[model samples]
Target chain A: MSTAIALHAPIEAASRAARSAPAADAARADAMEATLRALVDAVPTATLLFDADQQVRYANPAARVLARLCAPDKADRPLAVVGDWHPELLNSGALHLCSMHGSWSGEVILGVGRGQHKILLLHLSRVGADLFGMTVRDITQDSMRESELHARNAELEVAYAKLQGAQEQVMQSEKLASIGQLAAGVAHEINNPIGYVNSNLSTLQRYISQLFSAIQSYEAALAGGAGATEAESIRRKLDLDFLVGDVPQLLSESREGIDRVCKIVRDLKDFARKERSEDWIKADIHRGLDSTLNIIWNELKYKAQIVKTFGELPPVECLPSELNQVFMNVLMNAGQAIRDQGIITVTTSVAGERVRVDIGDDGEGIPPDVLPRVFDPFFTTKPVGSGTGLGLAISYGIVSKHHGTIEVSSTPGQGTLLRIELPIAQPR
Target chain B: MYRILLVDDEPNILSALRRCLASIDVGELDGEALKVEAFTSPEQALERSEEQDFDLVVSDYRMPGMDGVEFLSAMMELQPAVPRMICSGYADRDAIIAAVNEVQLARFIGKPWVDEELAAAVVALLRPGSARARAPKALRAQAASARITRVEQDDDGAIVLRSDDPA
Candidate 1:
């Protein structure tokens, strides 16, 4: 350890002057010492003073607090243990380094609070002959705040990713909704013409059948005998019975053919009516289901037999038409799933405050991977224009509007069950 | 022979219903079974209906001259024994509810109804003692159960069996 610390010239000159005039100005020198001590104590920096012997002399209040970190048992902060710029190197390395370089400064970590380490900047410099000064600036709080900011930034990035996913779903739904509105308008406009044309066709059929009937009757009368002159002339010429019977038979068949076209139009009209909106009313779910069945019967009647097991339930408050749409979508899907012959079972029951409807089918069931995404917009197993891929998606939306839930479960080849749980009465 | 009066604004509809009833009246049986006084104009139908006796009246609900409810109500006043049938489409729900009160032997025939449905309605109107005749609309519909015939393979690759299918 160095016996003397390199001191600054001005401090040495002042010390020399104090030594020489001490006898005549001892009181003034004493007052100067008190002022310097008070200034060091007032500063927040932890500062320490060492005497010519390189031993600790004076320690301000800040220095005393820092000393407790290294020397927990000591009342006096009498030393800065510096060996290779390490606090654990409790030796006079700063004292020796200051003598050669006139100053030394570096960052170090010290034991501060019960097993806690604190970052600190330490500076050592010569102040007078054989004297040294040390200062420490604690930097623990600054670095901690910096790390917390980094963690917060990472959290924000995750939240933004989730928000983007939700936005995409909303956009898809909006696009499909606009298309539905257009379809409804087209359907409403076509209703009237279909009505009259349909009636005309049925009548036309009746006419054909009647004409056929008259011809048959005239043939029968002729087969009996061509004896009466008046009757024979009328049968050979005007053929009154033939005109009446043949016309009716032919028209009846023609009307039947026209009626087929009318049905297609009517089914299309019902599909468009999904867009028609009315206030919520207490309505029979069975009625909605039945009407939906009638509308889509052509699709199902060939592929599947229907079984209805409806429970006794009070009329549910709902938009009857909208619910009809939901039923149609589910039922049609069930029918399409069947490759050949199958059975579709529709069961409705009241559970607690909810009305539960289950439509199950013994058909080619949904794949496990596909089932989860069945209600996702634009997700479909059908090829190209065979479907719009919005059936289940729209069904989901309608159920959601009614504050209800729809879920499906299926096995690969066994069957599928779609369950709809709706509130009995929606809040007005 | 049963006498039926059929009226509609549309010429095609009047001709169609008249022919259908004419076939049913005259066909299948040995001779003409019923007489239909068919007219395109409601005013003309009203004139003819007053000049003759009709067992039943089936009229289109929507007409430029007069709605079916008003037409049926007028028929109710003139021929109290005759059943009044309205062929209505999506429209006229409110009017039907109102007309149901004034009309005797009131019957509603949904437009684009199948041959079987029209036949049943005709039989019910003529034979008042039949089970479906006195039953209310809802009950009658229930009693008219869906008839599923034997399924047959169609050329289109669908196994379909249509029995009196209007659609």
Candidate 2:
């Protein structure tokens, strides 16, 4: 009877222990599920899980808020309840446009919801057979800033272009006005000789007629064997030797005067010719320098000595006259810069598809601050009446028009170099 | 006796030229023997040249109504054999090209000219059969053709002709 009671006790105790072990396993599983729910609720991003049929099997606390804002009944309901809210995501499996949830289409915006705002970057990916995971983030401030930055950049570009155009116009007008003023001086200088030559020629013609008549009379008197008294009177009154010698000299002087006047007139005409655009030819830049030197020779020759180092440059296609103006401006400036005997060096060479010309002056160098503003229109360091300050500015414009570049470099008390680079080929 | 046509827009220059010419004589050539018809206006010179003829046409390149090239071209049309001489203090590449191409000039004298060079240029131009009077018609035609072709090519290409900036 003791053995029987012991065997029953052991069996009953073993059965109780086995039952408690299953209950502990079930309790551990329930705690793990609760921990998972807490993690999803604490997550900042909206996350949702769908079953094979796209029904909302699970939605985190944040996802619930998103669903309520997008489609209030979609939390525990079928995903089809919110299908109209994101029809694209349903059809294409995933959609990335920000405005998918808002009135503004195709724009990135934060989707606002109950007690939370999500960037709501909608992304859908298939997890298994028909199950999917949707994720949303928040990026509200970044998108707005990017758009504003782009607009600001565009405005800056427009402002820069306007500034460049205004600078160019002012430079061009200054050049034209200077040329007009110089033209008047050139005209006046040429007219002085022309006036005198016209008057001298008329006087000379009258002298010749009188001399011829006198010669004829004297010859007739000598041929007719006039009386001694008549011959004596003719010799005394006429002073035949003086009349014959001095009259030819006077006539010759008159002829020379007329020649001088002709030359002055011709030069004036050449200087003032109307500008023409019919001829666009390939010209040697050296020729332009030479011509400019000739035009401004008077201004330079007395104060400066020019040194030329010409390279074997190819011909450049351009309007020769306009280029001549550029050279004239630079050369004149070089001459004016010198206070005493100084060297003006003009060097040319072929650089790539362009020709580079360096007009350097060994005069007082431009100050560092002034160097940067040399090409600014109407900015002159010279006295008021001496410079219009358009020389360098106009040169800059002309170079730009030719699809060229002008650069300046200077060292105080040393000198300045004006570099002009012009393409050999014409601007297409 | 050589007849010289002196054209200048300035009356002062005309008077000075008259005085200077009166002072010098080459050999037995009397200053009075040289007939000079001075025109302060280019139009007047052109009209006068058409009515008669001149041994030489001395003209200024830049004038109010017409330039030296145009004036010379007109003069050459009326009298092809007459020699044209251009003198200018403002001798630039354009003036040289115009003198060479448009005027088919006899000589280019830059100012302020020396007395000897001035006399020699006048004498040479006046010399019988000394001047080469042919103009390059082919070059002018080629220039025109090239311009047309350039315009056509620009049209065919996608080059935007931006409007001139009003700034």
Candidate 3:
């Protein structure tokens, strides 16, 4: 603002001098012209003035340098026509547009010399009737920098997309690694029932064959007219009464074993199912918890007893398998915290529009210092190879994705409790 | 009577073991009929063991309250001369070593044990002055080979073999 006022000070002085005396007007005009010429000549922008006949009236020092570079052959001669300095500008019709519209501005390429060109920004304006003013600036380096920046941005976007893809793949591979770890406990769970059922089946086969042999002996006695006492002796010898009573018991036990095995298989199938796009379903939380418990029961059964105090719950809209993974992680941690016989209690309740699940374990509790960092990725208190440490971190992510919260409270040497609260219905 | 104590967390396992021992007679057991008492809880079995002496004790390795090794270690205090056996589907090497070195466990019986092998192990443990060798491997090789062929047909069996906890 101050610079504009200072530039107008000379012009104002000239105008005021003209009013004071007519005798000094010619001397003041020449002084004003010299001051204006020096100001225009000092600026880097090329400045040109033109008369109504389309002939160059004056060129600033910067404009003369540009004319010399544009047309070296005509450098010695006075620049009278616009085409001699820049044929592109003369062909652009900017002068005609400025005469009609009062002003025009554009960017153009000016061929300097020797097959090279410079990008130029041009501003043309009509000063008064039959007079025109124009300014030009070279912007070749600035435009090159802008294009280079654009290319770099595009490359960064592609790299960012690939990084996101790799992150998703890592999450999936971690899930698979956890499944491999659980396979040992699951195999133990299944093998127990299989063990008992196989043993019972073998015993039952022997008992049946014995009963069949007793029948054959009785048939022979009846067909050959043997004494009644002989058949009775044979029945007692075969322990027919014991076989009759125990066969049904064995059959029932075997049936229960097979049922338990089938349930384990189904729970495993549910646990290991691949995530799908349309995997969201309204599911019973209790059922998912029960199945997850069944899968990890082998790991927990020896050290802890599970106590479930489940209240009435409405169906929760969720990804069932992912939530199952969360439960498995928390429950497994609860089981591992115990050094001996302990109690793991899982309680659920609904308060307003949210459902709350609290898993508490009476075990060796977490230390106060380590409690806060439990959810950090790759943080572990367990021995190496026993845990990947992604369990709680992944659970935190899953719960957050459901727009829910998970918190833990622990008293050293007493127990630890983990509480998860989730909205019953997801927001659309 | 030759009193045998059986401990397993699963009721079905106890019942199956009882059936496998049902045919033992006085002649086979050196003039005494085999009397089997089964308990699902190791603590309860230990309480019972305190009340009466047992000729032999066979227990599952994994159980609530006390594992088979601990239970047998306590049983050794009650009846120092009695032999103890551990039966389990899980094959934790450290637990096995502890059972052998600390408890002086007489036998390690794998689950889905052949009925004849179980009966033989029990009889051998009970017999007077019998050389306390490991459970006899009479039908083990044949049975194991047969089971391996069927492992793929049974998904759990395949997993049991593939798992790091190998028997």
Candidate 4:
């Protein structure tokens, strides 16, 4: 992400630019040689005088310093400097072209270090027969400044991308929080009415029982036929016997319906209670799995046959509500993965100190390429609007929070198995 | 003959509790006087209980003005030995624990209770020398600071304790 360019490139249009450039006289080449040498030495630019053999004849202070940088031992010597490191300096063809042409100016890059370079401006002119005056200017500093600016721009791009990801996570949590609050409110509202209705139904049931006992007592009292005709007529007209037989069964059925509603409301409340707190508790994984399964039973009832194989496990330390959410998310995903009929088998076991839970599904298995990316946020095979794609992501976070590891292995067209191994006690 | 007081914000709920008293086996109540009084207001129930001695008090956890915890605690101040039970749909964990420790709530009946379950709880509380009559304060204090054990289900099935609620 770096950019480098020579701003004052004096060589590309040297035919016009050379008019302002400092140059040695071509007319009085022999007469002003001494004066020209002194004038060139006074210039800050590195000026080198080369003989016909490409040897260094005379170098000004700047040229001497640059020579030491590229050629250390030959700094004091007037012999020709090695061309390997500064081949561009010597290979620019300025000297060769100056012999055939009037004036030659060109730009060449010279290696300053192993991988770094300096843009040098080479100006060549014939001072006398087989002798040439050359000026070199280093322009690497400006080029490095441009490169550093570009590198910083690239770093900012990486940082912005990370910020976007973090922001998305925050928004997701907020969304869940609002939804949880709404659910809790609804659960509470439902709870009050259900409470009264449940109580009333129980009272009705008791009243029915008492009425039957009263009828039994009346029958015993009238067994002597003291008021038999009148009582029999009243009973037949009111259909008392049928009423006594049907009411209890009807009440029992209504009781069942109330139970179902209570269970649903309980689940709704649990779902609404956000597990935002960080308090860790000793939790039983098996019980959480069943409640979660019952809560989300409708989602899987039609999709797959669930098989549960549980082993003895110590109560693992965790947030029960959060774990319930994790289980529901994974279970729902498993149910949705199946297109038609499939089997989702969940098994738990104790492996020494770690409790392991494996949820395996025989459905349209994840493709090899997509299997590894399942836990990535916003990654989903479900259609748009059907899934937010954060199920596995949240699950991953919850499991990680518990100091647990979740791994998934899948065979395309066969099945996928996700194993979550958690420590019984999370390390502080 | 023993008289029990039932307090709830809902008149219908109070009436239901009155009917539930009939279903409770009288033999289990030591052939005592079967009188069930119902009240819709906690203040009135408390005020009346002060004038007349009640053998037991069954109240809903959430009520208007005063919740079951506050109402029951105030009642305990007036009559300390009366057995009390709270029936609630939901309450904060802290408040429920407080109710248990502060008022010595005899038992907690979850919402949507069946007739038989309510009757059974009443019978258990009324029986002579029953643990339900007097809550153990020391045990409640110990339980208040006890380690939290959270249980969940596994793959096979859940080990479920029989719930007093209809479910």
lDDT by residue (A137-202, candidate 3, tens digit) is 777778778888899989999999898777566666667767777776676667778888988888
lDDT of 2 by residue, B55-93 (tens): 777877655556678788988899887777766555455
Instruction: For candidate 4, write residues A215-326 as lDDT tens digits.
Output: 7756775885648666676567545676566456546544654676677667656654655457778988998888777666634654578999999999999988777777
The full ranking of all candidates by TM-score, starting with the best, is 3, 4, 2, 1
Off by over 4 Å in 4: A1-65, A77-85, A88-428, B10-22, B25-35, B112-115, B128-167
Higher-ranked by DockQ: 3 or 4: 3
Best by lDDT: 3
Candidate 3 chain A weakest lDDT stretch, 10 residues: A1-10
Interface RMSD of 2: 9.7
Q: Residue by residue across B13-130, what tens digits does model 4's lDDT show?
A: 6655665676555566666667888888899998998899987899887664677988998999999888888876553455556666667666666566655556665665566343
Q: Candidate 4: TM of chain A?
A: 0.51
Candidate that beats the other on lDDT, 3 or 4, i.e. the better one: 3
Q: Give the 10-residue window scoring lowest on summed lDDT in candidate 4 chain A.
A: A1-10
- Cα shift from native, residue B8, model 3 (Å): 0.5
Model 2 per-residue lDDT tens digits across residues A118-137: 33455665544445555655
In candidate 3, which residue pairs clash?
none
Better of 2 and 3 by DockQ: 3
Ranking by lDDT: 3, 4, 1, 2
State the lDDT of candidate 1 residue by residue for B1-167, as single tens digits: 78888887655555556544543433332243777777767777777778787988988765654667677777767786677777655333335455544453255565555544565566556653453534467646632432111111112223221221221
Of the two candidates 1 and 3, the one with more favorable lDDT, higher being better, is 3
